[model samples]
Structures are given as structure tokens and as C-alpha cells.
Target: MQPTTRLKKPAGSRNEILTVGAGDRVYESTKLGAVFDMLINHGVPADVVLRDVNIPHQEVHSPQTRISLTQLMTICQNALRLSTDRHLAYRIGASVHVSTYGMFGYAILCCPDFRKAMDFAMRYHALAAPLATIEFSEDKADARWTIEPNLHAVAESALYRFVTEMQIGIHISLMRDIMGPTFTPSEIGLAYPQASDFGLPQDQIGCPVRFEQPANQIVFRSQWLDRSADLGNKTTYPTIVALCDDLLGDLKLRIGIAGKIRAVLLRDIANPPSFEAIAKLLDVNDRSLRRQLRQQGFSFRGLRDELRTQIALKYLRHTTLANEDIALALGFSDAANFRRAFHRWTNKAPSDIRGE
Candidate 1:
């Protein structure tokens, strides 16, 4: 069946609704900063986009910083508003280089062949784009690289199209950089519907663009998998991969004691660990852990409450669990207590948050 194009509500209409809260997905500032730079290159005022999104202009300059996904979406929405170019994503993506991704990109560039690069990307995608999931599958005739948002119920948002387009364009640009300028996907599939006004993607992607498909994917012949990448570097490959590994490991550690506590809680929310237990798990004594947490501006009870609130929102938005069951899962003594806590956390009833 031919896919129908889905137009999104105007950016202004959805801005407030899409604002992210705690526990929402985030992207590395380096990636978003690159997009911001591109917007400036296109003459979009930096102050205007930053002020609209409530992001400090200096924050994007730091590669180690992260920004919420909603903030990234808002910036894109503002970019579209301030610029006449509908192909902003593609344009920005086309300019991307292997270095833009830091060690992750270099790891790919160092792979001996396209197949090995694909394997590396599939294995370490989290290091590059934690907010999106990339899956690789193959049949007898063709290979597919499917991309989708990692978050639940995000594909319907207007930002999905822009992000998907930018990502697909980056893939195409990377492939051309590695395999040679002649390379192209056999076909491109997008979750969003086609728009006649957006004609440049078809030309830029150098393939037939199909919209409203089963998922966002790039299809190509399986044989291309074995094609040797021109930039493969045997000497530097292992070094770069090891560097990426260290970066990924550091990413976990950088999340801080509060983040570590949240992770522990999320892992076993029904029976969250006591502060003493959590400190032991983190390899520190309770007293030391408490001091460290205090230094980081976090308290154990506050962290637990925040985690519960985030989990409650996740359950309310993504599942049909009853209030009693949700309460039980969250270790509440009763539904009434859970309801009151939910209201206190969000200033809205559980049912109201659940839209029931």
C-alpha cells in the first residue's frame, strides 16, 4: 500500500505539550551543537533559537554536556520557523564528517569493510546515539538498517521526521565517505508521510524515498556489505575502538552517585534498596556515600522520590496498568498512598496523568 503523508500540528501549537520532564530521553550536546552551528550557518539567529528553547547559548559548546530530547526538538522547531529551508536536516547532515561523532565515527572509519562497520555500529550505537535504536537485519537479497526512537510513543511527534531525516542523511553521508562517493541506499523508508513540498531529500539521499513505511530504514543489496571501505585503517582501528569503549564506560560513571542510585532503584523498584544497601552496591560505606551525595546536591530520599515520580509517569504514559497494580509495583502500601504521592510529585492525579 502507498504510504499516506502525515503532517504534524504546527510547532507553536505543540511546544508546551512536548516540554520534557525528568527521565525523558536526552542527546549528547555535541550532536545538537552541530545542528545549532548549521542553523547559524543558514543565518538563523543563535539568540532567538536558544532563548526560545530556554537553553543557554554556551551549553552547546561543550561536547561532554547533554541536553534533553525535548530541548533538541524545540531547537529544530525553532530552526524551521526561523529559516525558509525545508531541507535543513539534510543540509546539516550532508556536512557531517566522521570526526563529528568523535571516537565512534573514527571506529567506523577504521573498519576494514562495510560489513564490519555495520557490525561495529550495531554493537556500539548507544555510544553514538543513545536516544535512537538502530537495528540491522538481512534477507537473501537485501540488508536493512532500521532506525527508531528509543522512547515510547515518540514516533508520532513532528520532531521525529526532522530527526529521522537528519539521521538517515548522516548515514548516507558516512557511507559515501567510507565506500566512495558513488554509493547510495537502494531505497529509503521513513515513518512519516511524504510531503510534496519537501523535494530535496529525494535528491540528497540519492535513492527512492518511500514514506509511511513499516519503519524508518535504508534498504540496500546485501553484496554491498562486503565492499571494502576506502578509509580502513588496521593500525588505528583497535585503538579507536578501545577509546570508544573507555568513553562508554566513563559515560556510566559520569552519571554521578544520584544517577547510580536511580539505576539501582529502577532495576528493582518493587523492592528498592536501602541507602546502606545502595552504598554497599556502589562500593562505598553509607557515611561516605551520604557525604558524596551531599556534595553532589542530592539526598537519598529525594533521589528515590524523583525516581518514583519518573517511573510513575513512564507507567502512566506507556502502559494500562491499574492504579493498585502500579502502586504495588512501586512498593506503595496502598493505592491511596500512591495516589497522594503521585499528586504531590506532579500536582495531578494519577488518573489525570494517565488521561483517564
Candidate 2:
């Protein structure tokens, strides 16, 4: 059997593999119209979704307002039927590039080394349009390019859309940015088999193309990872890398704060602390902490509740605690309160969560 590729699931138990900037995926002005249209057509209650985002039905049809990631996911959950199909998402993403940053983007991408350019793409892709993730993978002999979807309802389709368009645009731009649009990949692969008009552009460069692969990806010789032309755009690539490293660190804390907070809670389980106390320990103010969690696409209450629920379930399942004992252990006031809270957390009773 092929070695199983296991990825860490999100707190929501999502099986997605790509780490994406949730904020960046939303908030792109250019993508507002197409996404809105798709959502409305897909059976979401337009008014309800609009209310969730404070956008009116008319404004969604208008060209002025942008959509947020949260709004889009809510719509996808309620509307899009094939949101899980990764390929469809990629196809949608390919069309979004037109409204995104135009030629300057091409110039920046083509000028940088492969690694630096990839980092820039990941970091700023949200700024241009929040579609999918572009990441690099390397082994001893070859480098692979892959696309990952963000946490939208249409996770798979989104991944497909990102990989397809990104491969097409970046490949063409790579050569154009260097040698006036004449450069071409000696060999190319497309995960989706259907032909696109884009293949015609390869005629200009006389390169071989392959389609229908295991994943929407490209493989290239490692030697090509570096370029010699040295068109040197004056932006320091190393500085960009350093900046990406710093931002990634911040993102880790943001996304994984629940786990970090869980650790602290574990340490203080005997004497559960207040939110203010936890915020002070983490070196953030209460409001700032709440805002950061919101921006990072989560809530402090959600995290705390999840942690407490986990502890309650653990105690119920593994230990011989009565419901009242489990309640006390998890800092709840009493057995009744614990049962109500656990029901809220799992949509099942505490006993059900414990399989009792």
C-alpha cells in the first residue's frame, strides 16, 4: 500500500493539509462579485448570509464591497453542493487572477529565486485574492509544487482551483519575467485532464505537456531552482524570507493558541484562572486577546469551551468519575451545569460523548 499521508486535523476535525492565512483568503475586493454570485445561486439564504456579514443583498450584487472569509464559508456550508471537490475549487480560482494584482505581481514573481518567490506567493496571495495555498516540497532528487485549500466548505475544489491557475500563471510568468515571455518548461503536468485554451500558449515555447496526474502539481529538476540571469529587482530576497519566518511564527501562536492555552489550563487545573489572568500570562490585554483570536478566525470562548469539554470527556471515559466529579474537575459549578455545557459542546449529552 502507498504510505499513508496523515496530516494534522484542525480543531474542527477537518482533514485539510494546507496551512493558510484565513484572514488573507477573505477581504479581497476583487473576488467579491464572483463569490457572492456563486453563494446566492447555491441556495444559501441571501439575507441570512448577508446579515452574518452585515452586507445587504443589493451590496452583494454591487461591485463595491468585499467578502470576508467567515461570510464565504458560511455561504458555502449552506449553499454549494460540491464544496468538497478540490478540482472545482481550483477551476474557480484560476479565473480570479484577473482581478488580482496584475503585471507587477508577474514581475516580482519572475525576478525572485524559486524559494523566495514561493514564500512571497504564500504570504501575499491573500492580498491579491484569497484562493488557495502555494507551497514547495523537496526531496533529494526533485522539487514538487503543491496547492492546498483554505478552510472553506469547498475545501477540495478550492485546492484544485488554486493549483490549476497558479501553475498556469506562474509557469508562464516565470519565463516572461526573465526572457520576455519566451521561456517555457521543458515538461509540464496538469492534474486535471481536460484541455484548456491555456495550452496554446506553450506553442510559443515548444514544451511538452502532460495532464491527469495524481495531484495538481509540477515536478522540476532542482538545478533550475536557481536562476543565473540575475534580473535583480533590488528587493532583498533574504529579508523577505526573514519576514516570512517571523509571520509564520506569529500565525502558529494564533492558530494553535487553543493548545497553548490548554497547556496553561492543564498546569492550573487545580486552580482555574480567569480569562484576565490567562491574558496577562500570555502578555496580551483582554480586548486585544479577544480581537486577535477573532482575527485569527477563532474565539477565546470557543477555545476555552473546547478545552473544558475535552477534559470532561476524558475524565468521563478514562476515569471512574461521577458526572458531578467530572464537573468539579473541569471547573464547572455542578453536575447539571456540566451536562448542559457538554450538550452544547458536542450536540450530545456528556454521557453520549463518553459513550456511556
Candidate 3:
């Protein structure tokens, strides 16, 4: 048997107190679409799940449509409530094929090796699930993939568990498809506690599972990172990546002026360009840019602050950089000001986030 440990939930579940932002972020509809299709194919009445969640049946069919993360979670919650099986998430995840992801899937399939495929997946992950941010880190012995859901408001709910499980299951299934059936993670770390009658995730995931960890992650041997993908297509890899890029660009445009500005701000995080500079970059005058952003329910300052908060939290959680350096990287005047602003944004200190 693999090693396993469970920790007690922290006082008051700080995660529940943390805000998840405006909850306006969306994911590619294809993910939910694939799951719903599979549910229907399995003789399940998925329509009830959609109806209870207030999601139109037609919306799931369009790959171009983007669904908010909140709605997606609600749908999953409803599915779990209605389905008799405890492992509904695992089943849906296993049924999904890489081709279900459209261009994003193709890009991964065409990579020369697992490492390169992971690079492509990380770069274009938003194309599949914009509401979750993924990070990959590796040392001589192991590689870790950490998934941080942007839906903090639902962090303590069963919806969170279902979605997190489905995500892990999907990745496990995808990896197995690529590396062949024998591959498995070295271990799995989950933020949620184990269910009382939790199905056999260890057996399905092919690894020992740890619960209530600092983060949700999967660990695997580093040696496998260099393994060649069975479906690598060097001849079409470039074309597939280009096509994926186009899809990403189109998605950003669909998000409107606010999304475009957010993209620019992220790219220029070290020294965020001025409003006039960003307007010029977007080929619009300053006044027009402001007006367009306003129309899209965003202000330049608000967007910048949100972006900074996001980057700050990411740095605090994922990197060991000094708070002062993070402040500088975020273009704050100094560490003190960044701390004050961070508190105002999150109602918690930067140190607290890092400590977790």
C-alpha cells in the first residue's frame, strides 16, 4: 500500500473566507459539453441536471460558447445529487477523449514528448478551463502539477469536491491515454477531506491519496517527463499550435475590451504600461479605450488592481520570492504599499496567504 495521511481542517476554513473575485471568469463549454454528452449516453437523464442548474440544453452543444465557472460547478453539483453513483465524476472524466478539447487537445497530441505536451497544455490551459490556473514544477526525483481553482466562493462545498475530482480524473485519464495504460501518479494530494464512503479514487487514480493538503496536486516521477508521447506528430505540431493560438486569440476577443486589456496588463506585469500606451497597443485612442472598457463593465484601474491581486496571490502561493520583490514585480512603489493594497483587496495579509 502507498503512504497516506490526513490532516484536520484548519480553524474556520480560511478558504471559505477568501473571495473568488467577480466570478465572471468562464471556461470552454466543451468540457461540460463532453461530460453532459457522456452522461446522456450512459442512460442518465442529464437534462434534469441542466434544468436544475438553469443552463439551457442548447448551450452545451456549442464549442464556442463559454460558461461561467460558477454555473459549471452548479451543474456538476446537480449531477452528483441526481446520479446514484458516487463516482460519477470519475466516470465522466474517463469517458472524455482528448479530441473533446478541440484545438487545445490537438496541440497536446502533436507535441514531441510529454514535457513539451505539458508546456503546450500549460500555455493554452485557459482555452480549456479559464477559471483554473495550473502550474508544473519538478526536481530531480519528482514532478508536481498543482491546480488552483478560481472559484473560491464554493471552495467548501461538495461542488468544489466534485469538480476537483473530475479534473484530477480527467488528467489521469489523459496521461494514461498518452503514456499508455500503465502510467500512474506517484501520489495525489487533495485539499478536501476524504468522503465517508468515498469510492476507490486510489484505485481509479492508480496512486495513494492524501487529503487536506496545503494544495491540490498530483506527483509523478520526474523521469517520465521526458517520455515520448505515443501520438506525437512532429509534422503537424507547428500547425496545430498555430491553430490553438488562433483559438485563444478568438476567445480573448470574445471576452471583449476588458479581456484584451487584462491580457496586456498580464504581459507587462513588471512595468505595466500606461493607459495611453495600452490604448495605442490596442489601436484605439485613450478616450475610446476608456469608453469601451466602461461599456464592458470594467475600469482600467479596477482591472489593474484585480490583475495585481491575482499575480500577488500567485507569487505568494507558488514562489518563495520576498514580499518586497513581489511588490516590485507588481509595480508597487514598495513592499509597504503592496501589503496595504493586498489587505484591502483580500481582507487578509500577504503573509497569511504565503503561510498557507
Candidate 4:
């Protein structure tokens, strides 16, 4: 029998919508930064993100604070073209290829087991780059890997193309950290057409590289996935998880009730519903709504700004909406406010965004 498209899982109680949380999975390193970088690159201004978190723009790089899972998921859903964040999680994987860790490089060195290790990196890849994606599969005797993103045209520009190269480079480098430097892959594939664009293959990945392939993937012996390492790295897993916990907490720190409010705002924003109107929809008092948002890491004002930021970018990049029209659609007072906000988020004026 084939895998069913929909499988029912246990819901906690009647009328309760169950959702998957981050602790349920693992994420790859640097991929989280890569995803955050993609959101900035696409349109969500760093200042706005900082403001949403109640941090100054200059402090965004502070290692002390982290963003919340709710915020990350909210933004990812708004900004990404994919159907689900689970599909986006694959960006955390890098090709281990011929490294000393063998096929178990990521699993043995840093992960408790192959499955947990794979899932760990995948779960947090958003902190790295929003556009990165990795897919894993088993076919016959080989484990297959696929890494690529449906990057928007702006993200496909020369700068981001170079960024993609660096992303791939970091992936291999991290693998080398766990595995010996002598590692090589049986076969390597890339979606990019120009090998030169990625620089000399010998220098970049230190292995044979193939370009102009139908997809990007690496095939290796499946047995490697099950092999246990001589040493256990339980200590490493906690440290990584702790870091992720902190990052998620930073976003949660601000606007504690933002999550619940954001949900209602998303539904009524198109129709310009009043706060009292939205509160009635939730069957709660305004005070109750505000308090709930405080728990969710955002406020009504902040979520409204973020929602507008996401909507503006999608319209500008994916649609042919005029600036004036987009401004109106986003409920901005006018095109000027939209232009200013767009500039703040992207560091680029609307004309440049429109390629005018």
C-alpha cells in the first residue's frame, strides 16, 4: 500500500487544534541564520523584526537573546511559498560525502542517532536561511539527498547566487568538521548551470562536482545510517538544543500575547475589522486579548506591521500590483508609508524592488 496523503493523529480534546512544536524536531546549524537572512533579503525589514522583538536594530546580532518558535513559524508561513515548514526543514542537511565520519558523519559526531541528528538540523534550519531546503530519501540500497530552494528572483540575483554557493560550502565544511577532511562523495549534483559560478570544484567542495543536473542530491550506502559511533555525543545535543531554546525565547520575550492576536488579525485585516470586532470574534475581552498576545511574544501593533511587511513583499515580487494599489491593499495610510516601510525592511526603495 502507498502512503496515505492524510493520516489522522490524536487531537488533545474536542474543538482543539493540535499543532507540531519545535521540541518535536531538530535543526541544522547556520541554516537558521540562513533562513533569517532570506526573510531580510526578501522584504521583512530587520528593524521591524527587531522592533517586534523589542530590541534595537544594532542588537539583532547579540548572542544573548533568541526569537520564539511561534514567531518563526508565523513568518515562515507568511513568507515561504511551500506548503509546510516540515518540507522547509531539509535545508539543515549538508552532504557528508566521503568524510571520515563516513555516511554517519552528522549522526555519529553530534547526533545521538542518525534520525534524531537529521531531524534536529532540519527543525532549526530557519535560523539560518529561509530559502534553503534539503530532502532525504531511501531508494533500494542508497540514501538520497536533495538540497535546493524555490528562491524568489531577488534571492536568485548574483548576490544570493553567491550566498547559495557559500551555503553549500558551509554545508561541506561542517561535514568535514565531524568527518575527516579526506571525505568525498560517490556522486554530486547541483541545479545551478555554471560550475564556474560556484568557483573551481576542486577548491570549493574538494571533490568531484557535477552541475546542470535535473536536481541536487547525493547517493550513499544506506547501511551507514544505522551504524553507531565508537563515541557517544549526548553532551553536544543538549548544547545545541539549549542554543535553539534561547533563540526562540528572544522572540517570545516581546509581545507575549502576540500569537493569539496575530491569528485573529490575519483573518480580519482584509476587512479592516475593529479591535472590539476582533475581540468579539474570539469571545474575549480586549484586556484578555492583550494579555494573551503578551504571552505570545507580540502585540497588535507589531503583528500588524509584520503582516503588512510580508504582504508587501509577496505582492511586489510575485505579483504585478502597483505600489499605490499594494499600499492600499496592505491598509497602509498611503503609498508613501508603504514606500518608507518597504525601504526600512529591505534597505531598497520600491523602484528598485519593482526593477523600474
Stretches of candidate 3 off by over 4 Å are 1-27, 41-44, 52-55, 197-200, 256-356
Question: Which candidate should be chosen as best, given TM-score against the real structure?
Answer: 3
Cα TM-score per model: 0.63, 0.40, 0.63, 0.42
lDDT (Cα, tens digit) per residue for candidate 3, span 99-207? 7787878778889889887767766676665335667788899998897654442555666676677777777877777777888899999887888633435667778
lDDT of 4 by residue, 1-356 (tens): 21111111111222321222332121222333444555565466765433333335443444443443333333333334322222122232233232322223333356766546545544444434234466567756776567664333224344333334444554555544544455444566666665332232444344566777787665455665566643448877667565554544323322223444555666656555777777887788999887766544456666677766766777888888888898888777788988998888768887886684
**Where does candidate 1 stray beyond 4 Å?**
1-27, 52-55, 152-156, 196-200, 256-356
lDDT per model vs. reference = 0.71, 0.52, 0.71, 0.49
Residue 235's lDDT in candidate 1: 86
Backbone clashes in model 1, listed as residue pairs: 5-193
Candidate 3 residue pairs in clash (backbone atoms < 3 Å): none
lDDT of 1 by residue, 1-356 (tens): 21111111112322211112323333466556767898788776789867556667877767646765556656766766676677877776677767778788889989977888887877766565444567789888899889875442264465566667777777788777777788788999887777643433677677888878989998988887777677888888889877876664444333556657777888988899899989898999999999977855568887788778877988999999999999999999999999999998888999898775
